[model samples]
Target: MRDVLGKLGAFAGALLAVAGVIAVASFVIGLLSGRVSFGGLLVAVVGAALIAGVARLGKVPSLLGGYSALVYLGLFLPIVIVVIYAFNSGRYVTVWGGFSTASFSRALHDDAITSSILRSFRIGLTTSIVSTLLGTAAALALARARAGVRTPAEVVILLTVVVPEVVIAIATLIFFVNVGFELGTTTMFLGHCVFNVSLVTLIVRARFLSMGDSLEEASRDLGAGPISTFWQVTLPRLAPAILAGGLLAFTFSFDDVVISNFTSGAGHETWPLHILSALRFGLTPTLNAAATLMIGVTLVGLALAALALRIGSRQGAADFSTSTT
Candidate 1:
């Protein structure tokens, strides 16, 4: 029954791929006649390629590949739809008048949107830096400590991860009020740092454990002090993980709405906060354009993080091999 079903699925996927290919070919022909714009033709080509790729996935040896294809569609189809609509000519987000750059222009030109975005970036960058520094230090301490000390500390730190974000936000708000600190960007930065430190600590500690203490010990044996060893040897090895943690922190800080809302002072709105407020008014294609830009930035950050990790691993391997030889 499973094998029969798989065959049927593959046949359906193949049919879809053929349809996409034909549509793309028609768009290309129209492009040559100056009937189709280059952007439209490019989009058609990419869509057809994606459809063919999925169809190829469906034909893989196991059922897992087919399942993955379904998951991919479910996850990204809505995003693709929204991205397509971001270029809508009309003010209404859903009603597609045609491909237009008006929304992109409005979104970029709007003073509130641009200012909020700049504010968000400032907060995100500040939070990530402070959290990364503190977390890296904590991770080093915990990783080198005795089991009795490390185990309890690990649980305490990871508790932040397990706790709900809303709960954390509320707790932070109460703490700020009790401490007599006015809710503002500083408070938001503090809240973000608290959560991100634990995240960074976990990532850095994992990397430390995996890489072992050999390099640090070698540095020490060569008469480098602890600080020098850490700066020269340990930190370089942990650079990829640290970068990944910082990127994660930046993303979370930038995207945070609930916490930012609870803690933001008068006249201080982050980009997410601006979007949330805009939703109360009818959503516009401008909002969609903003969202699409945010998604693009996030994807770029993730790609860089992945690339950094890959390069760091290769460099570490090369260094280890040279040392051994």
Candidate 2:
């Protein structure tokens, strides 16, 4: 009993000693030469110490899990902030003078912003549709083609997908400059399409591989033509995956900044471009509100899609079983 008590006491004392040292160090550094505010430095030191303790524990505790939850929140929090601030009567990003809908009313009335938003939506839709169609077709072709041909095509597609966006953006810029092509929405559209194709192909290929060939064969036995079988049999099965993949592609195009930064033609501003330009002026809760709204929209879309897919899948399985038995 004595031995156990001594060991516990010593461990506790050592831990306290280490914590005290950390507290003292934090104070000294925070007060040093006015490089950092005392409050800010204290926050930083405490944050580091907490992170170090978590690392030393060698496992994710409930507290750590809560921290992980913060990632999801952080991704979305800004959007909520943006939406709320959009309605703020304040014209500027800062100084929330009063709660008013003047900003939203102003935003709605701004023809330029509205037009840009519409153009962005159009680009996203077109990109998603084009990328998904081409990608799914390529995936199907790869699955059915001779190994030699498929191998080369797959390699090309994989390379296109894996290449860094910066490289693609720079290359696009160079080509446009060389060709004397005026930057416009078209360039942005083409740039997005190029990147999206690879993403779409990978997603569709996974679905294709997982879906064995037997079902298609069975459809052929039922007197369905190749085209009919594809539309009726193959397509229905792939629809969920296609929609999911397309949504992913759309979301990507909607949020893309790096590619847009280089490809978007002058005078044709996008939401992201506007945001980037605005940041140079100053940071404000206005951005935060916009971010919050975007997060909400994305979550709502994903949730609706997931629910629809669940329902469709359950119905599909039931129908398949009934037909088989």
Candidate 3:
């Protein structure tokens, strides 16, 4: 009876979610038409209440209820917008006309777009590698150290993580201008690296902290040299955290606009710069198409990374638990 109730609750929650989504859509449609109706919003709220109620009954998995939902946001919204625009034939992106791929062709053939994409990709890749390597070192150094050193290391990590992106971007740009530093992709890349290094460090270190201390002790007890122990023991164990942190850093560098906007000099444009400039001239199909592509790539790639890591971590833990049992 309880199992049946659970399944029923889950189904009700799912249906309520669908209704809530439809209501939100109706509200948006009404909003775009110059006046939003309370009726549509009321319907959405009611549906959301039902969904929340069912979710509270303990039928829905928290992963589904929370983490997965949060993670899917970037993927879900972008996909919906991209699909809508992919079929839009009109010159204007906002007002739909009919289905066509003309905008996509323009985006592909655009030299400036291509150049910016290449620039962003190169920067993202380089930044990911450099940041991950340095950050992981910092993470490992903090994670493996004695108790006395850990608190300071943690404080440093927190400062970087919590600092505002705009502050760093503006500060770096000013410093460059004052010192006569040549502003280009290289500077942008390095600027991104600064934030990314801290981000990666904090993420990897968090993972390291979650993993208990037994492995390192075991390695030490085996009379293995520190280097050999780290290589054979710690690195393999730390690989997942490293990879996760690196993926996050790569995505950060790829999607960054604020920092890139401030640092990129005249005549040199990253994809973000192109998009931002184009927006001032009004929205275009080409911009949507290009943006759609980046959004899709980043969302799918990152989602897959998240899914893979989640599964692997769960399986590894399960295996460890079973063996211990």
Q: Tally clashes: model 2.
A: 14
RMSD of each: 12.1, 7.5, 6.9
**What C-alpha lDDT values do all the predictions have?**
0.85, 0.74, 0.81
- Model 1: residue 64 alpha-carbon error in angstroms: 2.7
In model 3, residue pairs whose N, Cα or C atoms come closer than 3 Å (at least 3 residues apart or on different chains), thus clashing, are none
- lDDT, candidate 3, 195-298, per-residue tens: 89988888888888898868888989989887998798778788898997888888889889989999998877888888888889988888888887777777
lDDT of 1 by residue, 58-171 (tens): 655543455556667779999998899998896467887889877888888999999999999999999999989999999999988999998898888988888988898999
Which digits, one per residue and each the tens of the lDDT, describe model 2 over residues 1-325?
Answer: 9967654444444444345456656767766855667676676677567546645643334334444455566787775566766656665665565676555444556666566667777888988999999988887787777988988888888777888888989899899879888898878888888878878888877887899989889988988888998898788988887888899889888878888899897887777777787679786554554545556667898889889899999999999999999
Score every model by TM-score: 0.78, 0.74, 0.73
- Between candidates 1 and 3, which one is better according to TM-score? 1
Top of the candidates by lDDT: 1
How many Å off is the CA of 7 in candidate 2?
30
Give the runs in model 1 whose Cα sits over 4 Å from its true position. 1-8, 11-61, 304-325
Candidate 3, residue 201: the lDDT equals 88
The candidate with the higher TM-score, 2 or 3, is: 2
